[model samples]
Target chain A: MTQQPAKKLYIHDVCVRDGFQMESVFVPTDAKVDLINRLSLTGLAKIEVTSFSSPKAIPALADAESVLVNLNRVPTVEYTALIPNARGCERALKCELDEHNVVMSASETHNRANLRMTRDQSLAQFAEIVRLTNGTVAVNASLSTAFGCPFDGQICDDDLLANIDRIAEIGIKRLTLCDTTGMANPAQVRRICELVLTRFPELTVTAHFHNTRGMGLANCIAALEGGITRFDASLAGLGGCPFAPGASGNACTEDMVHMFNAMGYDTGIDVANLIPLANEIPSLVGHDVPGQVMKAGSYDRIYPMPDWLGGKEQTRLAGSGNALIDPECRVTEVAK
Target chain B: MTQQPAKKLYIHDVCVRDGFQMESVFVPTDAKVDLINRLSLTGLAKIEVTSFSSPKAIPALADAESVLVNLNRVPTVEYTALIPNARGCERALKCELDEHNVVMSASETHNRANLRMTRDQSLAQFAEIVRLTNGTVAVNASLSTAFGCPFDGQICDDDLLANIDRIAEIGIKRLTLCDTTGMANPAQVRRICELVLTRFPELTVTAHFHNTRGMGLANCIAALEGGITRFDASLAGLGGCPFAPGASGNACTEDMVHMFNAMGYDTGIDVANLIPLANEIPSLVGHDVPGQVMKAGSYDRIYPMPDWLGGKEQTRLAGSGNALIDPECRVTEVAK
Candidate 1:
């Protein structure tokens, strides 16, 4: 076997902000705070505690401010919140967030459709948010539909690069290429990630993917292969686009961590610690979550021998015996 | 974007055999034959229609002979079946199958636990089956637990290579490395596939993966990158190890095709044609299958704008407008 890579992978949880925002039922402030606190103990590199979205705009996350204020902050884990505009940034600043995550779309049509503003206006708003922060907190711009736009289909590479250039020029040192509607194939993910990294070596690039078409984990793997170490995922695979019909959730946090840890990367978080917390998400959201590791356990989980095999010892003994009546022989008997 | 590769990928559907065997409800023989016939028109390279095991052993597929006789076989597609031993090989030969797929496990504990035979016994059985067929039909040997054995944990490379050497020595030209319990991680998959190809250049290495832990599509990509083109997938992602509790089905066929086609590889199978067929599986199996593309639609599926956004035309008009009274203003109003 090849030696396991020694690189450390950073996992950022956005279950509360990005995930909860799409839920039809309101996730209570206590539940949100409790979930964040539980996740804090799981050794994640970062947690997007909640969003600073307007209550009227995203009523599901209306408890964002309350969740932030009530959550017990972890010193080692950077706590961040989504800042949609100047007002959201101002609210986030008071809550002492370590990072302000601003959003826009690479596609002009998607930018208008999602944020109700032109791409230029969203960029201007981002610049104002950076100016408002005044270096008090780090700002990360999440370029939604950077991989592909649901409205415009595939976004042109030149347009994507140019948008990143504008975001970087506004003093943002971090950028997240969001597969907003899960249109990214692995080849596209690897190619764009490679170009972005080569073009902006100083910026920290993170991949945010949705498992809408079952390509979420695969896309994340491709991004990693293309040299991205930071990823944005949701606990219990809890996020999806409100406008995208029949879509599943985000790249599941526990599932992603489990795969990485198994592949010999140091994710710093044990997936065993995350599964229990993930299991509770169904009760919190009042629906089943799309996480597999929580349901199947980790790959290391050993299942007991089937009862029809008459236990392992019997099977082991019968395996070498020529006896025709043993459980080993039963397969032939049943077949006949 | 990279130029799409011209390499042809062979997708083998095992839903009727591997998938149906795991179902609690025995899909009627007519249903099995109908599903296989529908899948045949989708440009798949091969279909494992059913297994020739003793009917009593797998009651769900007790009508294997009936299914083969009743279904209208496609001219271009290769029809194959699982042949457990001499009896199965005889049954498969009488049906005039294009290929006979035999099986064993690389790990001894798993071999005994699953097939009620030691590794040696399983290999001997494979040799006997090959002798019984006498080169009349193609013989492919599927190595279950080749990636990792749930009972024994990771199988040693030396042991795995030795088993493959024996199978190849026994005149098995086509071999499938199966992650029977979904324990194979991507790094391990890539490494093993590379080693197998380099060592056994004569054998046609196919990857058989399960999405038990949500790494199905990712592992398939890794295997592809490792230079294996043939894949074993199930429609609607049906089929899981009956002994592995909470295990998910096989790598989803449509989803796999969707990813490969999107990545510029020619999978031959059109995902759009397969989706409608995949939609029928849940009703037939009496449970929701773990297929994402069938549920979420393909990545190209464009969702209509939310009703609150007025419509695409209105959004396009409001996108450049400075007017605050348009639907664009609703986000701010609602937030307030």
Candidate 2:
């Protein structure tokens, strides 16, 4: 009898590229290397290592080459970099990359604002970057603002499909439909995914969602229902578009892994291993991260009962409703 | 010609109860009143005003009676409160409440921990609360931890149905199935809603979700498709159960409203009016709120170029290979 195919979910960790870019403090090159190295052990399918952008645009990833060079590469994991143009692609190629990622915004206005290029100009740049790199490195085109654009209003589903078709025609290895501003709802996500998958049967479509509008995971589920098997998430919900105003954070990788694992879906990621790396992020960046799992602990992380738990006083308090005192009141009432 | 019935969605704001209860600082009674007054103008169907737990248990709502007395009640809006027991019910009976909300956990352990009663005992108390009130106020039975309990693993769907049946037998006006720990997935949501609706078609059901595991909104959509129209949301994503480990925040009200409005579903809520109130929440409580729309702004609120100008930037971003950067790059670089 043929062995049943193992059911597994693929997660692409975007912390190094997307997560750090949103932070107020710049993470060091060594820290980025250490972060990616730690994350690699967590069993993520891919790690978006860095962005090959001009140093002037994003000061955070100025040492992208050094960070990539120092990483402990896991044989099973794919490491990728974001290339905004042919120049960025050339820089990525110089790093001896196995794969290069390019992005084009679905909205014309956003494309211009993001890359300072019109739609044709960005596509032309992508095709040229693909040619310049040759077949040595894989090319994955990310369609930004696929669900909705921050600068432009609702993106028509046809508009998104058209972008995918153009990218597919270029023979790119993969496509990630990004909800750059978290404007997608489940129905819209389902409709878009269904349309795209129907048109591009051979394309490997992935989802990248931001939690800007509180629908990140919801959109992810919709995409999964729409037949998507891969997703991009950031640790501790770190990362936002460096160029996109008002965008907050990406969907938390640990949180996503926790949800998928709880639902009996295999994500390959170990939530326990991911937690330490997630917690280290706040100290590295000089601010608390957006992810809750790192600070609050996972569903299975148990706290030992207090020393007074079995005592007579504890028994009295436990049985009474007074033990249910509002948690917030403790702070103010004590302060007073 | 017969016009199709306008699709309507109901908004049940949980700000006063869920939102305030989760915060670290205690909101003054007047501030709570002012917030509810502003929210009343936004066309919410119901507002969960306060909880009638003992002052010793939930000191944050020590002024619950005063807040209830001062509410600027709208003609169409129903004001509700959470009643924990017979004493809590007696306290709530003093207020001119349109509805009294009672809760029982599906998990026996959780019911014991949260209410100091077993699941059966909690249900028994709910029956008494129902009998004592005698239809004087609408009683909404909220089945907490209905999706899955943090203490216990997955809650059986049959157990949820059994609880609903027990509550319905007591003549409760409505029921809300709560994913207290955000353990619900879309498929599970669909299955539960279908099973419940099929078994009890006359019962009005609402969905209460948390964004803990990122599937909150996804689960909501699944319920919507499963024929659920009512939902509970907290403004600015406020509220978490302190006693319930791993619980984060509720679904953001403005985000849900935005999705409903964009999908052409009528929620009768003014999305624009909600933004200012959502924005003010972080300052009132001395911490940043979790909701994203108030910070990110809506799709239409972004930069807009006048349409009458026949702007060159309005051109489509995708079409043919003419949009390609270079054929050589497309053939060579993107081939892998």
C-alpha positional error of residue B173 in candidate 1 after TM-score superposition, expressed in Å: 1.1
What's the C-alpha lDDT at position B133 in model 1? 83
Model 2 segments beyond 4 Å from truth?
A: A1-6, A242-247, A300-336, B1-6, B22-24, B243-247, B304-336
- TM-score per prediction, in order, is 0.91, 0.86
Collision count for each candidate, in order: 3, 6
Clashing pairs for predicted structure model 2, backbone only: A19-A239, A124-B324, A124-B325, A130-B333, A131-B329, A134-B333
Question: Relative to the unseen true structure, what is the C-alpha lDDT of residue B259 in candidate 1, on a scale of 0 to 100?
Answer: 89
Top of the candidates by DockQ = 1
* lDDT (Cα, tens digit) per residue for candidate 1, span B22-101: 77788988888888999999999999999888878888888888999998998989999998877788877889999999
lDDT of 2 by residue, A224-272 (tens): 8788889999998887653334545899898888767655577887787
B42 Cα displacement, candidate 2 (Å): 1.4
